[model samples]
Target: MEHDLPPVLSLDIGGTKLAAGVVTFDGLIHGWQITPTRREEGPRPVLARLFDLGRKAVAEAGLPEVAAVGISCGGPLDTATGVLECPPHLPGWIDVPVGPMASEAFGVPYALENDATAAALGEFRYGAGRGTSTMLYLTISTGVGGGSVIGGRLHRGAAGNGGELGHVMVRPGGRRCSCGRLGCLEAYASGTSIAERAREALAAGRASSLSAVELPTAEDVSLAAAAGDPLATEIWDETTWALGSALTDLVNAFEPELVVLGGGVTRSGAMLLDPVRAAVARDAMPPAARAARIEPARLGAGVGVVGAGAVAHDLLLSGKSDA
Candidate 1:
């Protein structure tokens, strides 16, 4: 039966985008499709578009049929029941029954998982964590998310959402996070936070090159910093500092062999990685610091779709007969 398992359809829902692909058991993706979420349109329209995209991907992949469907999305969701429970990113989407909707649309069983949790499994089974027994994954994009594999098993925590790595407190009574926390890592280090910090600095009448760019983004800040802009440098350093501080705690707590960082913001590469690596090395417990290796994610733009596919692959192997 294992050898006879069929490739599955994978869908990833994000605040800003939606993606679909057909993924085989071998961890390869085919016919990937991407489109803007336009989340303001709400669940029904979005779900219809997502299903249409899945159909397009299947057709493009030239597959006669898929064994199952796997969906990955931001949470505060109930994975067991397949409900989307008011994720902060997708404003106004409360308790949408994504799993049943997806199953009905695709005419197949569906596996629903937290996006970050699924990504951890994706990286663990196919990417940077292939050889490691314990690994951690963080996605620092529009928001922050984390997942882990401990002792060679995916650790979904008690809530089944795995870990909320972004919520780690980095500053007491600091900037308000989307989670309503006063000082979460996401408040200071997420791509949104980075840009917000810059805009706030400019609003405070600080002089810097970033002011020249209208509505500057995190990428703009990194580019400005690379060009020797003092304001951008300050913001970038603070971002790295927050990441370093949080990563130190994670490395110490998880003691993973590898920590893979991904998502849009990591495109800055060394400018982002070098300082975080240094901070973890200098601050984490010696055993943890020496044992952990932090690296960028390998899946890049396709991670969500590939991760969703990985979830489906695991579901196929789970043998739970959930169809």
Candidate 2:
């Protein structure tokens, strides 16, 4: 049945970039296009460009039309209403009616989902989580966010933003998170936080290989840690600890069959995976730990487009959207 579904237009809106593509049911993207978001221009102009990008993608993919359109963006959103509610990444964006606007622009139904939630579904349906009925997906990029699939279904949670898993408290009063909370997983494990911590350590007169770079990033810290830099190692260890601790709690609570880690930070590969895996293994409840296998995400840079596509396909399949 999935193979019979028509292709859909997928759009991903991010703080820094906008991506559009035509995605087939098999999780393959065609005619992918990307551009700077320039969010300062505000939602109206940005959405217009995103719609144009979708048209371009459809044209380039050689499809006369798509079944529907799917949209993925950062959360603090209302999925039922298809409105973006002040996502932190897009500071000035308020209650933008993304779903309706998208549908009107393309003359087709649209499904708007939290970026991480859609990514989770994408992974579960087509990526590393293909065979798993219960799984957790975390994207440790500019910010840490996650979503869960339970009993072979995506869990949208009460407010439609999924679980907001990044907000889970890992250390009380340890660091100020973007959510204004202290010690949230996002405050330590996010790529932004990793770079910030490394920069702060250098500013505080700590020595490390990271000092050679004018502005060290999470990738820099990862590289330095792998090369045996003391300060970098300290920060990296703390990052992995925060992730492992948070994941352990999640595993104990949800007992998912797999935990797939994605996003820009995951590019560090085993440098990030090995320690976090070890931590969850050592600290999680024995049964939960045994049931869960942490693995890297299979979809790479195109995940956002593929994720949006997957959401659209689900919408069509559910009879909630016309094809």
What overall lDDT goes with each candidate model? Answer: 0.91, 0.93
- In terms of TM-score, which candidate is strongest? 2
**In terms of TM-score, how similar is model 1 to the real structure?**
0.97
Q: What tens-digit string does per-residue lDDT give for candidate 2 at 265-288?
A: 999999889999999999999999
| Pairs of colliding residues, candidate 1 | none
After superposition, candidate 2 runs with Cα above 4 Å error = 1-3
TM-score of each: 0.97, 0.98
